[model samples]
Target: MQAEGGLRERKKRETRAALAEAALRLALEKGPDHVTVEEIAEAADVSVRTFFNYFPHKEHAILGRNPEHLERALERMRTAPPEESPLTTMWFIVHDVLRDLENEGELSRRGELIMGSPNLLYQLMMASFDDERQLTAALAARMGEPESAVRPALIVSTAGAACRVAMELHKNAPGRPVRELVDEGFQLLAQGIDPAFGPNQSNQKGHS
Candidate 1:
């Protein structure tokens, strides 16, 4: 029964991936507004009901924000060694997630899709805000602090900003590994985001 259940879960994940990939391909071919859940389902060889089961709307399908992926990352963060700082644990979790995204060109395609659609870009920002809020609450729980505390909110929001900047940089430098960019972003954070120091001191001073 356990094996059977695992197989079923695997199949569900495959179906979800298929639907998301189909949605992105369609969006790329014929803009996000022109695509429909029914068309995506048809392309993925699933019914519209199945598409709805995986994603609430077409925008979500294109965005490809799987709740399972988020839960998996949260689980990793929750189970990290007690001695590890929350920020360190966050980098570990993000590293694994970004590694997966860097596979099979899907991340690049999704980035292109977002850049092409203003509405999709807006929706993606809103979704990111939701993710930030969720991570803030999770970080609070991990720290055994009240959810209303300001520290967790600041940490998670700052981390989100770092990730966003890394993503933008990665989009420009497509040949470089995204993990390296992310690491550089975190390292800069660790050194404080001041312009007076670091390898780009001259550049930073000029900007200042």
Candidate 2:
């Protein structure tokens, strides 16, 4: 019974991956607005009904990878040693995942496609914040702390900002590795903003 269940789960995952890949390929070839659900189903070698069973719509197929990536990152964070700081553990795991995306030759294409489509870009941005909230909650639970913990929120927000910065850097420096961009962002954060902005003094007159 266990073996059969495992096999069934594996098959479902494979089918889902196939469907997502097919949708992305069709979108890239014909433009996202031109592709139909039936066409995506045909590209994945599945029926329209089967495609719907895996993904409710074409956009979901394209955007589902983000939640999947976040889940994997959460799993890594859960298993990491207790001695590791949450930020460090998350950074290491996320960096590895981004590196894998780069090595698969999918990052550039995926990034370009998302950036080109306003709808897709909006969807991704919303999903990213949702993932950040989920990660923060998961980390709080794993640490046996309350979700309202300031540290968790700070870590999540800072990490998210770093990711955004890294993505922008990647857009400008396509030849550079994502890890390098991430490291540079973290380094800047570590150096503190005070050096760039000066201390607490303000230049505004009559503001105090």
Candidate 3:
């Protein structure tokens, strides 16, 4: 029974991956707005009804892939040694996953495609925000703290900002690992940039 269950789970994962890959390929060839669910289903070699069974909308087919990595990172953070600081654990998990993606050569083309289309970028941002919420909740639970704790929110925002900056940096330095950008961003945070400064020296220096 255990072996059969594992096989079934693996098959389901493969089916979902096929659907997502098909959607992305079609969206790349012909802009995301032009791709239809039926076309995605055909490309994935599944019936349209089967596609709906896996995803509620065509956008879900493309955006759902983001959650898989986020979930895995969250699980890693949750299972890290109890002695690890929350920030350190979260950063470690996120950096490891992003580094692996960088090593796999999966970022350049997808990053360009996502950055080129405002609609797709907006969808991706929404998905990323959802990931932030989930990770925040999981981290709070793991740390035995109230879910409304400010620390979790700060952690999520910091991590999200780091990822956004990393993506922008990747556009210019495609050869550099994203972990470097993330590390640099965290270092800036650690150096005590005044929160009231609005990320500018004028605000920090009280010029206006």
Best-performing candidate as measured by lDDT? 1
lDDT string for model 2 (6-45, tens) is 9998898888878888888888999888889999899989
**Cα lDDT over the full model 3:** 0.78
5-37: candidate 1 lDDT, tens digit per residue? 999999998998899889989998998999999
Name the lDDT of candidate 2. Answer: 0.78
Model 1 lDDT on a 0 to 1 scale: 0.82
Per-residue lDDT for 164 in model 3? 80
RMSD of each: 4.9, 2.8, 3.5
Candidate 3 per-residue lDDT over residues 138-177, each given as its tens digit: 8889878788999887887787788788878878887876
- State the displacement of the C-alpha of residue 119, model 1, in Å, after optimal TM-score superposition: 1.7
Clashes of each: 0, 0, 0
**Candidate 2: lDDT of 66?**
36
TM-score of 1: 0.86
Clashes of 1: 0
Query: Which one is best on TM-score?
Result: 1
